[model samples]
Target: MATSELIYSVSELNREAKRLLASHFMTVRVEGEVSNFSAPSSGHWYFTLKDAQAQVRCAMFRGQQQRLGFRPGNGDRVIASAQVSLYEPRGDYQLVVEHLEQAGDGALRQAFEKLKTKLLNEGLFDESRKQPIPLIPRKIGVITSPSGAAIHDILTVLKRRFPVVPILIYPVAVQGESAKFEIQAALETANRRKDADVIILARGGGSLEDLWAFNEEIVARAIAGSHIPVISGIGHEVDFTIADFVADLRAPTPSAAAEHAVPNQAEWLGGFRFMENQLIEKLRRQLSQHRQRLNWLEKALQIQHPGERLQRNAQRLDELEQRLNKAMQLTLKQNQHRLTLGSQKLKQFQPIDKIAQHQQQLQYLQQRLQRAMDLKLVTLKRQQAGISQTLQAVSPLSTLERGYAIVQQHDTSKIVKAAADVALDTLIDTRLAKGRIVSQVKEIIRD
Candidate 1:
């Protein structure tokens, strides 16, 4: 166990071989016949770089393909700048291409130059045909593969800068045999819908053959004919296509296309706030002016109508006079009632009324006194008659009427009750019932 050798698995051995080969041949220029060429949906190109002796598997990633100047055919001879490496998963030796160019006659390059010159002479790439990008687009239309990194980068940038803006995606193949037709059809669809304010034709960086769709005359004409503004963001900054020349605007990358499509939300918000403050200040000034005008109008109306003040004063005087008249009438009625009540009280203290009452009372008292005197006189007469009748019962004059005699001395007027009682007088008078007689005493007789 102390002197045991290090063991290696198949994967470890392949990884070690890849590392060693990559370090030894960082950069190499190889001449080969292009064969078994293919470009997958990932924007990576795979082909065979071959000579008469041997052939090597070659891979050109999307990023490194951007430096390719011309398209390579199956039998074309080319020089490819590449790195030697082992594909660990397959344990296969390969070359990773960074740049590719045609070798001897450069027919493809001459054709590219000829086409560019022809288009330039026809004014297809004139600056006058270019339109300006809108400051803020309502909707941004994108044409690219849905799964491509170009679309992802474009969407991420658009969301970060202005999330409120709407986006419409038109999925299409950005490469291969049908890529040109699909791109042209997408441009036509965008124009028919008229929904997007600006159209962006985008794809990640790639070689000339990988980006051949954008170079097609049909795609270039579609971009030129679009009513909506078109922005081209195809390969990297170092790469350019015919679509880039015909589009209204050209951006170096897909993310840059999105940046050019919309303004930053924060900057727009700041501008709106500033405009709001300015509008508020303008409104305030207008309101102040209106208030000043109103004040001036009110003062002018007051100064123009001096007679209105006199008319109001006259109306007030009339109202006060009516009130005074009503007050006087009410006071007169109250005083009349008081006077009537006082007159009734004064009648009770008047001397004339008191004398009249006293005269009636005195007349009543005199009538009562006269009646009492008459009653007293009649009562006294009745009492005197009764007394006369009682005295006559025993009176001598009454006895004379009854034939009884009363005797009296003539000189002394003495009456005799019996013969004995009357002594022999010198002369004795005797009175019969009707007459008196005088007799002398001749004898004293004893009964």
Candidate 2:
């Protein structure tokens, strides 16, 4: 191997290849001729699915052969639904067949798709509508053929996972023309009785025709309508059915369905033990804290005596009393000293003497103010005389007195300044300095 390169053992390599192939080609429906077919004592059927150009090994377990219509020999053409896988021991690639059909069974495949589309459009296969499967069911109801390997596998797996839960078998035919009716009735009956918390609808793998009962609308509707959540364990891992879509949960096989229905007992027990130990440890820690507190309280009570506390309180009261008395004496002394200083200062003020001095100053100021007022009055009177003379010089009355007459319209009192101010025969008013006269114009004049 190259340095630092990851390497795998033969078994690991084969397992990894098988997982890759299984995940890559989840379900394949292929047509090929059967060759080298063999059925062993172990109830398993082995064969080679081949075409002219290629071949692949195939296995159909006995559990899947109940409804296989005919045994396919070499040279027989067939169709199968299978998953690609590698057998680790032999390191050989092979196909694990889920269902086998004769050359012309493509019609069933088409019908399944058509029904799937119809239900999907109707919201019957909606994820929101699916009920939650109970992790720990009180009781589980199974709808399948009582004698089939599917029922046995489910019971065995349930015993291994969780055996406390009761299993109620609702015997019904898992194949044939009446299988759909039986399944529908079983589902309705399980719901009506309310005996089981969850329902498991299961059957073994077979030809497409044999498993068609699960693909029927009646069975699908019954599963969808059931009050109890339904878990469909139909055929092999590669098988797809209408019931699978309608059910709350779908498992590849009956054993897997049982595994999904409950949790592992060993794991749960281990978890419970761990939790119990943790709880005990926490309780111990709390008890230790409480014990420490109790011990501290006991020692504190011993160290602190009630009599000692009383003595300390008495001393504090005496100290406070002495301090209060000293504060009162100091306050009184301060007040007395302040009173003496205030009295001496009040005597020094001498309000009467100060008032007399202020009166004298006020009298002198009054005389000065009176003199100033007299001068201001004289100045104002002079100014008034000058303004009167100025007004007389430019006054209209003085101009009129100088022999100039003012003329105006008699009725309107409008002044006439020019010859055009009067119209012919219009009445006029003429005013001298002393009086006014009214006259009429006899002639028209223009200047």
Which portions of model 1 miss their true places by more than 4 Å? 1-101, 104-108, 307-447
Q: In the order shown, what is each candidate's alpha-carbon RMSD?
A: 51.2, 34.4
Q: In candidate 2, which residue pairs get closer than 3 Å at backbone N, Cα or C atoms, i.e. clash?
A: none
lDDT of each: 0.83, 0.85
lDDT for residue 217 in candidate 2, whole number 0-100:
92
How displaced is residue 155 in candidate 2, in Å?
0.7
Cα RMSD, model 2: 34.4
TM-score for model 2? 0.47
What would the per-residue lDDT of candidate 1 be over residues 197-220, giving only the tens digit for each residue?
999889999877788788888888
Q: How much does candidate 1 score in TM-score? A: 0.45
Residue 189 accuracy (lDDT) in model 2 = 88
